[model samples]
Target: NLTTNISPLMLMVMSLERYVAVCYPLRHASIITIKNTTLSIIASWTVSLLNNLTRCLFLLQFSLEKLETLLVKDYCYDINWFPDSLRERYDKAYTCLVIISAGLAVISSYTGVVLAARSASTDKVSALKARKTLLLHLVHLGLSLSSTVYHPLLMALSTLVTRIVFVWVQDVFYVIIIILPRCLTSHIYGLNDKTIRPVLLYHLCGQLKISVKPGPC
Candidate 1:
């Protein structure tokens, strides 16, 4: 959950960076420097870590039930363990607060970026680049939202229905949504940029020469 939290926070920061770069170009280099970017990342991670750590502390107050196949076959919900007051009420309220705030922050950041891309740039090349950047972030935001939600319901169904089918579906979604995003993030963000493409090609595929032409690599 903490790891999931970090991605959206980082993406929002990236959107803000893009906003400054596109809308306030003259001052962007000075305003969004390496030190500040690093600090922002650290702060984002810190917030996520703290939230999840508190969750862990809450969980540690109770003992987890041991897994039993017979119990799994009979019951979908855990009979051995029940939600205490902390989780039943407080945890949900806290989760809602965090979700609302973070979701709004991310959506606002990206929306500002898209609006900035549309209105601030007149140059066709610059505008196209900004659009592409926005598209990538939109895809990221969709995937991030999916990662937080409903398919876990399928996993819950596994305990009641045929255990294998829903579990497989859950696993497939996990791989596509969570694992692929983290693993292919470099390619998704970097490979399409002309400036970065040569470096990636050279390093990843051992291509000796990437002609620095003005077209697709």
Candidate 2:
């Protein structure tokens, strides 16, 4: 849950950074300093932690009534454990809030970059690259949010298949929906960022002793 919440928040920050870089190049250096960036990251994690702690309290409140039933359950799923009306509503509301906020941030940042890129004074090449990076961020955000539907998706699939088949389907969905997005983030950044690509390749293919040249690979 902490990762789930923090991921989008961090992406939002990254998008904002790109927006500032492209739209207000001179101000980017002054505004996006090391201390400011560090504070933003710290604040994002703090908010995510507080949000998770709040959800935990809600889960505890709802679970108290079904303590015995929960204790006997072989597997613990959040939806099954916190099936109360209030908790479910809270979960949905919070999920929507996060997704909407992150989506808007990415979209608006991209839009700003596009507008700035059109100006005669701006560097078209850099703006174009920033636009692509922002688009990837938007796609990555969607992939990350898809995990929210994992439980309901599995529940629907279970009714259509045998237990064995349903289990197989569940495993596949878990990997694609819940796991893949998190894993893909590093690759997305490494491949797209010129500075990081060589380092990433060097470590990934270390046995090959790949050269980390300043020139394009």
How do all models score by TM-score?
0.73, 0.88
Scanning candidate 2 in windows of ten residues, the lowest lDDT window is 70-79
Clashing pairs in 1: none
The top-ranked prediction according to TM-score is 2
Report lDDT per candidate.
0.65, 0.82
Q: Which digits, one per residue and each the tens of the lDDT, describe model 1 over residues 1-217? A: 7787677677767767766767677898999998999999999899889877776565555654532322444335432233366644554675566556656755665566556656645344654565566567657766765665544465467566665676677678778877766654575567767788778778777777756554442
Provide the RMSD of all predictions against the true structure, rounded to 1 decimal: 4.4, 2.5
Tell me how far the alpha carbon of residue 135 in candidate 2 is from the true structure, in angstroms, after superposition. 0.7
Give candidate 1's root-mean-square deviation (CA, Å): 4.4
Off by over 4 Å in 1: 63-82, 88-124, 206-217
lDDT measured at residue 135 in model 2 versus the true structure, 0 to 100: 88
